[model samples]
Target chain A: MNIEIRKASEKEVPFLVRTIIDAEKSGTSILPYEKIFGLSEDETENILNSILKQNEEDCELSMDAFLVAFHDNKPIGAVSAWIEALNDVSSSVIKGNLLRQHLSMKNLINASKYWQNLQEVHFDIPVKSIQIGLVYVAEEARGNRLAEKLIKQQLEVLQKKINQKEEKVFVQVYHNNLSAIKAYNRIGFEIIETKENLDKNLLGVLPDTKKVLMQLINIKNE
Target chain B: MNKTEVISQLTPIFQIVFNNPEIQISENLTANDVKGWNSLTHMILMSNIEESFKIKFSLREINKMQNVGDLISLIESKK
Candidate 1:
């Protein structure tokens, strides 16, 4: 099968959103929105409509880049990254505060906080890194290394984008998703931090969602 | 490591991870080909490999391994 990973187009939003929602774990539901933020269905459509309406702003806003993997023009998987420029400019304080409020549920709260903090870390510094979030490969395509391909493409894109200031690429994986953690580990990311007390880490929504935060601090220079 | 030696080392890992003595692992066998190679078991397998081999594996290599053959190749390269 011919697989291509590229910048997702506006038309692909509905399909991509559906794919994401379908692939969601029973624990969490994926709500569509601009740049793939997990929010309520009502919030997602409102954001999508606004984005569609402002298509001509020529806005070079550096937000998260969402790339989809297409096989024979069918969307099968997706990966996302935060634009370093936006990471630098965007205010993470609100998100951080929200996560802090949810700290009672150690796992989910900590995962949220870790994700938010990493975004801030990558944004504050000129780190040529990609925050790999929402990586999903169709179940039938699980063993085919499609996730690896998506990650390789993500690294390639990040490399080209930061050619001058080039350094390394990185991603975050959930603590409980051992399969994904193992995969990421195989790909060269190391566990920089393990959030044990998920309850007191972020906005306490639920008490069961535990996750590990990993990073690829460096890559071979070859 | 020799292929036989590698398999010998891996046999215990398989037994522990899968909890099935009937499992006869060959170079071509993969998690997909096995009955209970879910994500949870996958981690157990990886942890076993790490503990037995005394070497850490990166996420990239862990995700790319498809079978016993692939695992052997990775171990050889690391050594």
Candidate 2:
């Protein structure tokens, strides 16, 4: 089957949002109100509105890219990436210089706390790695190699567009998602960090849930 | 090896892994039949099998394995 990966257009934000909600329903199963990012209709609308607003201004909080996978003109899956500024307030201040030079000073001051609180990973390396946020294959479309196809196609596109040697790919998966973890490992992603403690913190906020984050690093092996 | 030989070989592994006496295994036996076959237990089983068989399983094969028969097939292929 021919699978096509295309940039999610502004017109398709609703569809993308819907797909994410449906996928989260079967995928995460997080209880309502306990969800960090609400998945309900109105909440999804708010999220989409924020994304659209950022897109219109070309000033996103994070370097974001969303793509949708389709087969025979029917959407099957979607994936998104965001380049996070792990740390370095000075660098972020410099980077924000593009928005407004006058606000650069204020931006630096305001962003200091946010940037300071930013979760630190391995950032000494030259590679500007991205955190894969959303990777969802429709429940019906799963297990037919569609997930593999979607991921491999995206990897190929990213490799061609980005410097593979300098860019590392990363994703967080729940430790219980054995199949997903297995598939990711088959695609050459290795577990770099296990956020077992984060699971406990999340459980406190969530009341009852056991979600462990498994970080996969796509760096070249030594 | 035939199915019985495969089962006979796997019986000891299952017995030790699950700590169950008189553990019965068949071509269709799966983790669902045994208690404590979660992710951690699965890792232990995989490590033990790898050491015993002197063969490592890729994450793909490990995840796709549904029963003892699937594992036997993977082991046979390795040999």
Q: Clashes in each model (backbone N, CA, C under 3 Å)?
A: 31, 0
DockQ-based CAPRI category assigned to the predicted complex of candidate 2: incorrect
Candidates, DockQ = 0.01, 0.01
* Chain A TM-score values, per prediction: 0.62, 0.62
Residue range B1-79, candidate 2, lDDT tens digits: 6656666777788777656677888777655455544322344456566777788666445545556778888888886
Question: What are the clashing pairs of model 2?
Answer: none
**Candidate 1 CAPRI level:** incorrect
Relative to the unseen true structure, what is the C-alpha lDDT of residue A164 in candidate 2, on a scale of 0 to 100? Answer: 60
lDDT by candidate, in order shown: 0.52, 0.51
RMSD of candidate 1 to the true fold?
Answer: 19.8
User: Candidate 1's error at A121, in angstroms?
Assistant: 14
